[model samples]
Target chain A: MILPEKTIERLSKYRRVLINLNFQQKDYIYSHELANLIHITPEQVRRDMMLIGHSGTLRRGYEVKQLIEKINSIIDGNTVQYVTLVGVGNLGRAMLNYLKNKNKYLQIIACFDNDQDKINKMCCGIPCYSINEAEEQIKKLNINIAILTVPTNVANEVADILIKAGIKGLLNFTTMPLKVPSNVYLEEYDMITSLEKVAYFTQFIE
Target chain B: MILPEKTIERLSKYRRVLINLNFQQKDYIYSHELANLIHITPEQVRRDMMLIGHSGTLRRGYEVKQLIEKINSIIDGNTVQYVTLVGVGNLGRAMLNYLKNKNKYLQIIACFDNDQDKINKMCCGIPCYSINEAEEQIKKLNINIAILTVPTNVANEVADILIKAGIKGLLNFTTMPLKVPSNVYLEEYDMITSLEKVAYFTQFIE
Candidate 1:
């Protein structure tokens, strides 16, 4: 069953925390204990577990390994999901380095840029191809998700190209808003807006 | 009047779009036109404007310049808000470069890191001080907001120092969860969760 976007994100977080708990040799975790780790309410955690059709014993609570496996199956499915990055600029390079080997199921297999210098070079061990080769590379590599870090002027242009090349999901980091087809799942992340929101909230905090 | 966090973020987005519209010589915009630009519903835009106590004329729609001025006052007070970055890693440097001179009212004045080799260096024209000097620098800079990009192991350790140094707001980029006092505004942005959410939704789109 398809879950809400927010629930999926929380499940991913829960899996990350549970992995750490499992590493620490913790066998099981109460809903409140897990909730405290991620700063979510116990009621919310229980609701998510219920939505995922998982139940825990009153004595031992939810099994850490079992919960993680359930979330993994829900979010990632079976095969590894291949991703590509478009635009090898500062943000793109930073993302490439940070996400190089971070995920087990999700991998950034390649990157594309219009810069002559960046093309044909390796960034964080991922080969950078010219924008001209993006379609061929995407199709050859079976890449469905793309992380877009191109300039604002060329963001939509690059997005259109990526979508036409069979990209089903896009994570946009450009300052400008992009208009994509309804079939494409788009996630827009704006650092400026995030910073501004933090700044705005600080006033009420004090 | 205080606005909800989501509304504040949308206000920031609307201002960005409005500034672009102002640059294009557009003077008036209806709620629907503004909503279309940001992919939000027209009613939501109208409600946000109403919350901020702004009105539009039926004949000409909302005056772009007036709305921008009103939003500016609501989001940002008269004085500029100073910000600091912790951990001058790849993500931090990219943020500094991308944010330098980008916002008139918000400025990232300084950054802190524990690496002695990077200490006392200028990154993107902002000074990189030793993390040991974070408290002094934060107090001297009158910084109320901080962007945390430190390693996951040391994120909370550094956050504690930053809190003691007078930072009222935090934007955490670490994978680990942070626990802050209620008076401290914290925004956690986990890129892994964001990417996973996009990947999960892509399956349903097709």
Candidate 2:
């Protein structure tokens, strides 16, 4: 069975909750109870589990240990993949800080910036290098994922450099859409579009 | 005709592109061209327009002036709402700065923080008040929409406060599921959950 894109996202979240519960040594859980934590129907949880090929008991929603193992196996807990940030702006820096302390599964190994003052320095113990050193540093650091935090005007340009440097996945934060090779994957996060949608949704509140 | 939820979001984005084109005084945009700008299919743009019932000429695609007029009319331009911020953390402050000066449609009229040093100071000319004064400030400012950026530990508690203050719509950034009334709409923007989902999707990349 194949999981849908949106369902995989929910699976990651469900895994997170299960991980927390596992730490607390909480054994039994009901679909209705898990649904209450996630603000969704218990039936929806069961349906999502089916996408990932997990079967649950009637009274109990899912086995916490078994569910965590299933989700982890599906989520890919193999070799650690290192990621690099391309820009050092406000949003980029915030992401840099977040990636450093959070996400034990992922590591932000290096950062690239054109700013001379920001170069040759360490932010939260991660090295920052000139954009010219990208290819060299990527090989040196074994970084596979590139987080594009550069400005819109240069997003595609930097993306080309990252792709050429052999980055497999790109997490793009710029408003500009990068023209990438079909082999490389792109995920964009545009705050403007998200907030505007929030503003629009506010209009329909009953 | 009432706009679908997704269509409303696209229309909000379309408005921005139209504003850009209007500044350049360009007339007659093609659906394909708008699709490129907004990163959607031409068929999607047409379907969105159909949802709004704002008919545009096939040759013209959608007239910039005419489209703006229809959108504004449907969106109720007279009463632009104010959005309140409940936390003064990095994410909350970043949201304030991100939303500030991006668009003039909605304003961050007030911000709340429990820290004494952060309270009463002007953040981008919008005053920050104490969390204790949240209900009073919400009523005084007549704000209906709120963007909750508090830590996950206190997200539910703060949401209860905002709901009590007559907040109709909430854009929650915490990972926790809130138990608000059916009338109060909630949307979560948890970065940890989002990034984990990204990690899950990373496997699908060829």
Which residue pairs overlap in candidate 1's backbone?
none
Best by TM-score: 1
TM-score of each: 0.94, 0.88
Predicted complex 2: DockQ? 0.44
Write candidate 1's Cα lDDT for A1-206 as tens digits.
78998899889899887775453388888999989989989999999999999999999899888888888888888568899988888888898888767677788999999889888989779999999998999999999999999887788789999999999999998877889998999998998888888888887776
Report the C-alpha lDDT of model 1 over B54-106, residue by residue, as the tens digit: 99998888998888888888888656989998988998888778777767778
Give me the candidate number with maximum DockQ.
1
Residue-level error in angstroms, candidate 2, position A124: 4.5
Chain B TM, every candidate: 0.95, 0.90
Window of ten residues with lowest summed lDDT in model 2 chain A: A15-24
Evaluated against the true chain A, what TM-score does chain A of model 1 have?
0.95
